[model samples]
Target chain A: MLLPHWLFSDRAGLVLLAVLAVLGVGVPILNLWVPPDHPLYLSAYTVTVLGKYLCYALLAVSIDLVWGYMGILTLGHAAFFALGGYCLGMYLMRQIGARGVYGDPVLPDFMVFLNWSELPWYWHGFDHFGFAMLMVLVIPGLLAFVFGWFAFRSRVSGVYLSIITQALTYALMLAFFRNEMGFGGNNGLTDFKDLLGFSLQADGTRVVLFILSALALAGGYLLCRWLVSTRMGRVLVAIRDSEDRARFLGYRVERVKALVFTLSAMLAGVAGALYVPQVGIINPGEFAPLNSIEAVIWVAVGGRGTLVGAVIGAVLVNYAKTWLTGALPEVWLFALGGLFVTVTVLLPYGLIGLLQRREKAA
Target chain B: MSELVSELDAAGLHTPIEPVDATHGILLYLEEVTVSFDGFKAIDNLSLYIGDGELRCIIGPNGAGKTTMMDIITGKTKPDTGRVFFGQTIDLLKLDEPSIARIGIGRKFQRPTVIEPLTVLENLELAMSGAQRLDRLITARLTGEERDQIHAVLDQIGLTEHGGRLAGILAHGQKQWLEIGMLLMQKPRLLLVDEPVAGMTPAEMERTAELLRSLAGSHSVVVVEHDMGFVRSIADQVTVLHQGRVLAEGRLEDLQVDPMVIEVYLGAGDAYH
Candidate 1:
């Protein structure tokens, strides 16, 4: 029951954080170096699952920054994630070249098989990893900034803001599902070949991608921690507790909300970017509003306002989903719904919240 | 950005100082300020000033615009017309609520606004943190110095014993004091506290009045209170507002005898007057 004192002490805390960061880097490398059949080997399947979990943690951290701190509950964060994934996926698709099932050198397999003449106008320059990476961040950041600027300035909040956010994602999903829109319609962009220069299917590449994902998680966590620790962080907490009081104190409440919202969206985008390469697919299903709702559930299950809790919740919930879906596929939706109700009703802080309470009591 | 009239120190009646000054720092100022809501004048041509480090009481009837005046000064609601200033340099009308706050203006609503889910200590910490605009950068561990400040503020507010307790669990008076403690952490040069004794027992009222009086040396406090006895205990000067204007201004005794104040509040030859 005792967490290491280093986990809580300041100097020791940083040491522990460093250790955790090292372990984060270690996991993917461990998977790569140790033979797959070795007793300690986490297996490709395990690495993929855990890698995906780390990505989810990034998404949860993003949600926590807005919903937990700034008091802006976004139901559309998954859309940002999907946009990032699509951007990365586009690059991967470009790398496929003449290797696609349709054997087209320039067009992606979907476009070629569909007998399309060329790459869509919006798909330009995705062959460069740098441009794709830039798109991964910029696209989501811009969308969040514009949406948040309008919503926060208008004072849309609480349930209304959450509803509007959900509506936004749903709209994106519908648009992406349309075939003529050039996003591959219902099938989405797939059949990726490489990233930068590495073959996407190589285990070495997968392990490196996993390491990158872990590094991103650690970096995102540190960044969020730094933000909340600053004077600006306290202001976000204050805004979460009371908006009008914060506004009265002379904080540009709308600007603060917009900034936090956009930052959160970017984090989600990074998560999505990492997710795409590891999963080897990006689809319109990624933009499904329900996926975003699940992200919220992850935050709730872990702990609503606690960032670590959000991460923990995402891992725990998704891990359980993997097991439950495999074991009882027919009832998985019921289990998921039941889990939400049970967590929201009984364990409002989810598992992490419960642990925090116990720690406080101790 | 709207044009900000630097009328805060335009009268040159106030001298600039910290904590407390020679009654001239102009901690809070309003000149020809008018606040109208939907064609109805809530505060009309209101003009008032609270000197630096002065514990001034604003006593008025129900519709006296006392709360609205605080709103204007804190930049919660802009005046229909007029100048509002914090110190000699800053035009409050030019700022929004958060900017006014960063400029060291603190306001406590009549109701306690501490987050109930948070402990008293946590509430104070959140208040000091203000509003963070970044998400990915807000999760750093609390520093020792920040912890020390929270402890000091807790002790100063007499809530050291209750720091671990939830703010919602505190009595009304204690909650009020906790909010005041929260405002104190910002080390605000000026504090606008509305009705610090509204729902308190007499003992609580007395304690609160004592608390507000104690804050005088370190901060300029403008307390909007209807409790005359409480005002008498804390007010160095009292201003009575009516129909959105200053009806009377002076020491409590002087206002008690003002004919115009009597006419507005007491009516002619009232037994209380």
Candidate 2:
């Protein structure tokens, strides 16, 4: 039996998500079996591309929480993601001890080369993966809380709020890029030997990382889905439409905005932590303003208010980037810029939104 | 008449508002209230009291500070200097807008400000109760009791048959009634309605006056209106505001003949007849 329509009324959506997940998990296995010299043996590169896209999807979901629902368009999302990655990078560097080019057992090679005798006090407990993960979450959460507390309490919204967010990320980028900041200067931490005591180069480890990425994406989507379906979600929409009316209706509007913004930052942090391991690099470049803008474009091009659309947009955009960068490397940035303008001007509702419109009309 | 209907629809209509027995007890008490806007005293040294469940009409020409006075009471505008009390013990000055709303005080603006895009039923549903927290919002599924309360409000507002229709599509008179229905769902201890019949048809005006009269038994209502005939039909007492101060106060019949009231009305009495 084909099953009742209600039983699988959203069948197309379910099938699409399932197909993406299968493709995600299948790439690492293919990489293990295929020879490196064959034209079809591009599984390793595929894994790297998809893993990075999953990280972007996670960040996009975080942005949707604030901008799509709570009406907070944070341009500081890259800061939170960088903070999480830096935390993980700290742990990875500690594992390199004597193996580093400087061959200092008690210190990171950079510290040894720089002739630093001791680690910074903040870098103390990062040697443990558990503590590093905790730091990843806490560092971003605290920054978001403090930033939101001051900005929201002032009742800032609209363009003013967006400017402040941009300034926040810009400030962090400058701070992280400083040579004396002990965050690997501009280069950041890289060249990981192992994570959880498993060799990162092993196929089994790669497969496990791919599975984790899929799990993270699914979890992020579900969390956002639950949030936007609630009464709080309705209140958020109300705030977006008419803030003054929401206030008169008995909502503590500022508090609601702050709460959602902080939660969004924490989610971005987790995505950053995941991105560093799979990509095998973490740098101050991750905090660039353009990266944050790219995230907004992802959400906008996918369908701003739709949760699943963000993930689909992230994957599709990155997949297109892989093909274009290899074939038309010189014009890739132009194509990306042109695509954004086209989507904004003619496809404001995006692919998923267009589908929804068709469904409604039909 | 169409203008009146458009105005009525803008203001949102209501149920048969009944008066409470406490109408003679103690209604609204404001002491030494002062509000300023742009260095101009909107309400200067204003103090007023209303009896419980009483229907009182406030009349003032433009710039009389009538709207400012309502703003202070409903927590929209805070006074630079003054104290406001709800019932016997509630200190209204310290409460924010949502807190003030929770304490059984409802204010209807002169313009119909109902949630426009919601279905009539959904609008009523939103107004049925208050959710104090986001968790409450998450768990707020409509129960059978809530459904019954919503249906009763619809019945009283004469929108029972139009529940499924979008509130945005309602006729002017019907929209006004829907807004009134929203306030009714709160079952407020006191109701403040501004310009209740400004552009309403003769039929809508009569029905509204009748509705206010019916509401007089269970709830205390203070209506600010420019329509003397509408006020004469419903107001038990009248207060006249002028230049940000109370100029006169008494029964509608008494104010109708007062020289000060006549001056404020400014040859507009011919229309009332």
Candidate 3:
């Protein structure tokens, strides 16, 4: 297929693609082909964790699409991410059919535990993989469209928009925590068996999930890059810089914003859908405002407007988080806080920006 | 109001607007308009008109409602009373800023606002009148004809060599000229220019004056300028606004000597020379 010239011209994007290609090919080989006793063997735990990082990276890119390029600092993207996960989790719950502690074929363990007579109306169609996949995109997209339509139309922007987004996720977190909300309550959806007949616990399934995540991250990156490269992308940047100027130029500012916001939310949804199976659970904790803020920190630390920077930042920060949380559990939050403050005060443009500046200087 | 609705219905019935009804020779009309902010009237019962393809200059002291009048004409501010019309048929009051701009009225702000992060060429391309639909914008590529049009505008603005440069890096005068170039890309029949030469060097001001003069025959240009020399160089007819009303309207030479014009300027400690 023919690609636009701008896509090919992005050197950082090409580098990112090459790296994902290497991971896509290399991780599977090391995990499945290499002998388990060998020094080079990649463990399943490591594979699952790496897969989770790729999901986070995709989420970061989604945040960057709106915050970095469009100047909308979304603080509630985790809500979309959690909502997507819940949609897929519902399907996974149905996949548990007759295998739960209560052995209820029609309803999930939580619903059975709660004495529900039948599956809720909303969960009726999640059994089919295709429908679940469609919901992964649609649920988040519909929420974003409705939210953005009202917010952008009323011109709620800047820090106010960010605050409302945070409130949105916080509200979701509260609602999902309720035992009567039809989801798994505070514990969220878990105890999944398989997806599309492939056992999620099997090493081959794990490897495939990781590969899919890498692919999704790559796809998400390209979609965002393509969007920012087009004339519409310029319009987004124009809106970011001076909204009044864009309006005066005859562009429908609110429509453009709502469209991009919906697209970004859908992308975040894809990331979350891929996340649940690898992690073995989806919980209300994923809807925390802190998770959304952490995603923003990743974008800021990587480079705000650069798509590659989001990926790089997500992986790097999460790697540090893994190490810190494991080594000194109490210090992890402090370390994360320190890192954000340091990045904000010293490195405004982020790691990618610093690299670019050095290249210019050279 | 009924006429306004019928005009809108007629506009909806046809994709292309029947050329703005300038048959009576007036291209813009602001009749008995009033605007208030916090119980203070900014534009108090004002009426103004511009002839078809005419270049008009409006000069006034600070807080004399010069900018407010432009706001009303461009749909940025709605009057509490009275009607604003684009030619004889189109009611300007009913439209939003983007819709007003689409219907051949372009505005240049006082601060020379351009998308600083974009290249000069990109800025002009964005301001072009067509291809603003969401689908078109998503897949938009610069066609050969469009590129040629952008190049023509670059030359017109005397920024042909600077087309590839970021707009933010351009000098203040160049940024101003680039904004004017953006307005030109809109193909507006009426241009509302607010202080086009505020901080321009004499040479830059002379060029801007020439550009505005050249645009007069094909476009009705309403310039609100504070600089008397720049106004004198470009305007054939001038309107003096004081306390939100027309103090005087005539040739600059005639208005300069008017007792009321001098008193308004002098009382406000403003040097009109």
Candidate 4:
């Protein structure tokens, strides 16, 4: 398919696609062909890490779309992300089928342990991969639509709206943590054997999933680029700059906001679904408010309005986290906080702004 | 309800709007419209009328409820008691701002409020019909006529050369003109223009006066301005407002001598300047 002209023309976007394409093909080659102990070998663990970062990058892009373009700072965005994961996680659990510890073909291991007789009605079609895939987009999208409809219609915006979104995720976290919810309680859905009858443990499966993650990130980026390039995207920018003026121009401000928010949430959901199999577990912890805030931080530190900046921020921040946690585990939190403050204070437009400044100077 | 039914039937027979009723000679009407903010009457029993295809200029001093009156007409503020009508049929009071705008009333605020990030051309595009706005979002393409309409507005606003520039970078006078251009793009039947020449140069003000003068006959225009010279240049009928009531109303020549109008608005020193 011919991509939007802007995506290929934009230097950062071109660089992003080139890098993703290289990583997509090269990582699998290194992991599969290069022998371990040769120092150049790619480990299974690193593939998972890179794949997970792609997911985070996608999530950060989702936040950037709403917060940067539309002026909607949704702090509860990870609720949609985790909700998408849980939808896929449910399917992953159902895939365990006869292989689970309880070995009940009809019920997941947790349900059997809880003494439930049958699968919940909401869990019916999730056994089918296609149905689960539909859900990964729909559930988060529907939730966002309803939430944004009420919020935008009431004109609750700015920091107050952000606070309400945080309250929404915090509420969901408490609910999902309960055993009665039938989502594996605190343990979450785990012990996935395979996806589509292929052993998930296989090098081929991990490599393919990794490649798929890169494509999904690229696809989502292009889709967002196309959206913002449209007149509607300009309207989103208009709304961010001056909402009342937009309304005066006969644009239904609430409808526009609700639509963008829902779309952004669905993108976040896709990120979450990709995240689950690679990580192998999801729990109420995924619904944590902090996770969503961290996603926003990624967008801010990278560049709020720039699409490639989101991916860069997500990767750079996560990479810093990985290195920090391992190298100075006790000081990780302080270091992360310091990084956020320094970026926000010094590099207000983010690392991308720094690059642009250097480019101008040079 | 009976009149509405008959009007709807007449519109169905015709192409939506029949000629203005000769009995009132009014395209827009306000009767006993009063609104208070914490015991201060922003609009106090403000009865006013505008003839079809007439340009009416309203001049008032500070806190004279000029903005509040526009707010009421555009459905931004609900009057505690009054009737606001567009033509003979539609009740402006009963509608919301969007609906009022849809029903052919457009308002420009005191301050220029352009969507800063969008180009001048894109801002005008957003002000088109809602269907067109949605179409712009889904497809970046535009029909030939829509493109013409945008160029026409750019030319009309005298910003044809700056169509590609972001509105955020425009001068204050340009932003005001851009906003008026946006309102014009909507093709509203009635325009409630506020402070149209607030921060304009003498030359810019002359161009604005000419723009308002030309717009008057095809579109019923209500220009609320503090610039006495600009109002004199364009007003067919002038309304002088004081503490939310029409203190005086006449041709600008006659109102110049009315003691109430002189005392409230054109103070002794504010004369002929």
Candidate 5:
């Protein structure tokens, strides 16, 4: 069992994998085998929440791939996430055949309520789980490709690129909120039932989904880690440090940016797809510009340019967010803003950098 | 040797560049080129020819369009009017910066520009002449021969021991040499080096002069430098530019003594010396 040099050398990555493995295997046993009364028993609710955190962690990693490594501060990644959620949500909607309030066998509840006679052309393929899954990867990927092609080709970068990405998610939020867009308006696509013949509400299904989320995070981390370790990864760093130098080196800078952006978006889509089932909702609200910015804050707090830092940051921030929002809901937004400012000013390299410095000092 | 050529060919080392046609003895041709910025001419009716394997020094006062000229040749700036050609067939104006670079023109900026976060070896590797296509880049591993080439460049640039060190940590002179090493990795047909010895110590400048002189016959080297002493040490031919046009073209000795050249440029101050 000789490990590849990249995996062998990565201490943080190994630790991340070990933690994920423990969670993936340990959570299920604790939830299923241990009785509810036992102190060691993990509730299904806790498992679902942990699964949601993994999904957020995956999304943060996706953002780091582009923002941390490629130097494209995309403040619109939530658009990809929401789009992926909507894709899976559509499938779930179809799965609710004759189970909705309107009891329409073919049309979803919203469509029946709106008096639409048939499914939209785009909604036709989502009925099939495989197609829905493919869309989960493709739709966000295609949008990123088209957007990045125009943006990078035109040489839109730095703060301008960031602003445009923010605008992108803002625009999507407005469109998705429209009832005429065919995605469930403000109410969004919810009221899902079973997936692949397994009820999402069941404890077994919940456990499996949590494991899958963990697996997805681990896989996404490895994929990004491998990519950044390659020569292409060096090219990306070169582009980030100096675009002109990369271009003058005869590397196609725009194409690389666009391709990496598309890949990052696809990763976000997978995170979102995993998210929808665990949370049992996919709505326009997910596309809020603040959600995208918060994802970037997670990357910054954990540490930019280190793949493992993103997961740590996302989980820690969301964990704090969960607690803070529960304990002092009025102060959550302020705390988040203060944290971002503090990280930017004091911990420019983020927590990983601080730890690395301490290790060197020791 | 043939196997090596084929290996490099498969690796796309020699694919993008059409062999430069310098049979007529000219490597680069810029004729009647004019570029303007906001109604002011940055380059005014500039006509220049670089002979094959020539070490030509371009000296000019500030606003004389020396940097602008390099920009035009490297496809960074589009000339409003005129013909720019690489060898005889490739119209340089038609290509973008990366394409221009791929087709064998490499430019070093006035300030040293290297990927500081990367190690010196990785910086050189990125600049190596080969398949920069996404698929190739993603899967690219250094062949023994490629590693050898990188080692050769490291030795050439005198950074062999520092290859593993992050480029950002290198001294000013070392970074300049590393940049030149990167250009060497490109295997460029023509090298456009701008102000290579601007802030270097006398010893570093001497080494840089020696390096540029050594690079001439193998690569057509056009050096734009301000330090007259440094320029005199390496320049075989000198082109003096003034107000976006060639003021004089001759040996440095002849240009230094030319009254018109002296009046506009050389007479500026002892600062140039």
Candidate 6:
């Protein structure tokens, strides 16, 4: 929606914007205005599901920024996502104030339960929305910068980087699980009550958040579009295809990879921050290696390089997962694993490739 | 080490402000450069020099360290012991691969790499990003002059018609030419070309020679080729390597008849044409 005119002129881009606009506006009306007993009434649960998908869409776009565009297939991207969620979660926990069972003003209930006398220094400023927002962007951005700085400068690439990223998230998961780590033990941060003083239980606030998630998804898509349109984006693609050739052409390949990597992490951070409020909890479970792997599969199932394909992949896969877990229950993981295998073999470009083929056939 | 070629420059016409002027007339210098992969020395105590705007061709039988030597100069392979310099001020060993290119030495690989997914036009665009890339990434659209420059290179490489086509779909020879054209787009002061005409047809070889020759007065070029006919066609001075050291250095005709060169290069078969 914020795109400059010349950049926003693509027909597919326009269609995506239209779909997002409709969803952003219509979903709120359906959730808030229509009475629940009506046939076309949107359920609150459906609103939450759509909001979760939007956040995942943002995560998928973030992953695509590096994996699809630059070919850095990270398996630890969920680490950044979980970190961002924890940051916002800390702020929400602070907002809980004296209402907790432990009734400690500064320490979260978990810290009080652990007999911690004071707020940890790292957890100090997250109570402020401004500081929390900054942390949402910076912590993941800084970690990615440091990680990518070492990895890319050393020219570690392909599967090696992927392994390193997996190790990164797995390490984060273990550290967060420790009771001494001060991030709420294995349960992580939860029991959020409000955001900016609006009741988390309020349907009005839920509707607004759902709308905001849609807006963010649109913004992320356009941001990626702008990036890939730039000369830097072309340089990334060149690096992806041939790093040595791009290096010989004097691209400062490490810097390019680091820039995209850090930015991708920040975007994932935003998604995780958005994700926590709607889901009503953010746990160490979000940092699971399986979650990151699932995100990669979503991008693959959508289309590796296409930004729109990532959004489609995330929504469709999650929708399928949600539907399957409720209906068949036991077969979700097998279905997901099978989906990944099948996509790799038959639908190499995922659903987007299939659509393009159908369009040509038409 | 290269023979003094100041006389060649005094007769040549080129950019008024040349990238190489001092440094004792050498554009590139490698002294006592040694590199080992495992215990085997791929480049052993080798020293070489290339004069500015001099189209020097290096020819050696297999494993003469030709590719490895290019690697050392371009900062891909670090040497165990050596002083490598570009012009005089820039130390080639100290800078990374991209910086070597930024300071005006572009290299072509042994195998062609034209970034198959990118179009010929995009390949040129990316090559243009070697210098001042941050600014280009933000505000640089090809100025009319810059677009014209790409057009001119496209015409030179005879791929003007295929600028929009992805390089993957190009003919094998065209891919080679596209990579060369990509190097050309950077407008590097020196270009290290590796086996440029290896699999080219005779006509393509002839045109490539013409292209290389036309580039000599403005750009220093180091061409390493195995094709004796191609080397003879475009070499200004030939450097022959045998066992990671210079075996012969002179005009191709003179080196071809050198009995020492014949014994080292031909190996009793007299197979080299």
Better of 4 and 5 by DockQ: 5
RMSD of each: 6.0, 7.8, 2.4, 3.8, 4.0, 5.5
The ten-residue window of minimal lDDT in model 3 chain A covers: A1-10
lDDT of 6 by residue, A170-211 (tens): 999898889999999888888888999998888988888899
- lDDT tens per residue, model 2, B64-106: 9888898888777889998888766666776666656656677
Runs of candidate 5 with Cα error greater than 4 angstroms are B1-16
Ranking by TM-score: 5, 3, 6, 4, 2, 1
In terms of docking quality, model 1 is acceptable
Q: Considering the true interface contacts (CA pairs under 8 Å between chains A and B), give the fraction that model 3 also has.
A: 0.81
Off by over 4 Å in 2: A1-16, A34-42, A320-345, B1-24, B59-63, B109-125, B128-130, B161-179, B194-214, B224-236, B251-273
Clash count, one per candidate: 34, 24, 0, 0, 0, 0
DockQ for every model, please. 0.35, 0.35, 0.80, 0.57, 0.75, 0.60
Q: Model 2: per-residue lDDT, tens digit, A1-362?
A: 58533224445446655866786656765777778877666565567667778888888888888887777787779889999899998998888768888888868877776789999898899899999999888999889988887897677889899888898888888888886888887888887888888877776676677767777777777677777656677677768766755665656677777788878888899999888888888988988888888788788788877777777777787777779999999987898788789888988877788888899999
Measured against the true structure, the TM-scores of the candidates, in listed sequence, are 0.80, 0.85, 0.96, 0.92, 0.97, 0.94
Decide which is better by lDDT, 4 or 5: 5
Question: Which pairs of residues collide in candidate 6?
Answer: none
Predicted model with the maximum lDDT: 5
Q: Score candidate 3 by lDDT.
A: 0.91
State how far residue A127 of model 6 sits from its true place (Å). Answer: 1.4
Measured with C-alpha atoms, the lDDT of residue B179 in candidate 4 is 90
On residues B1-273, what C-alpha lDDT tens digit does candidate 4 reach at each position? 778865644332212323334256788888999999999999999999988889999888889899999888887788999998887877666555665665567889888999887889888988875433454567656789989999998998899999999999999989998998989988888888988998799998998888888888888999988788898889859998889999988899898878877776676464436
Interface RMSD for model 4 amounts to 1.9
Worst 10 residues of 5 chain A by lDDT: A1-10
- Docking quality tier of candidate 2? acceptable
Predicted structure with the largest TM-score when compared to the true one: 5
The CA-based lDDT of model 2 is what? 0.78
Per-residue lDDT of candidate 6, residues B88-193 (tens digit)? 7666776667766776788988788898878999888778733436657756667888898899999998998999999999987888888888888888888999
**Alpha-carbon local distance difference test for all models:** 0.80, 0.78, 0.91, 0.87, 0.93, 0.87
lDDT (Cα, tens digit) per residue for candidate 1, span A239-324: 88888866664456787888888888899999999999888888899888889999998998888776777777888889888998
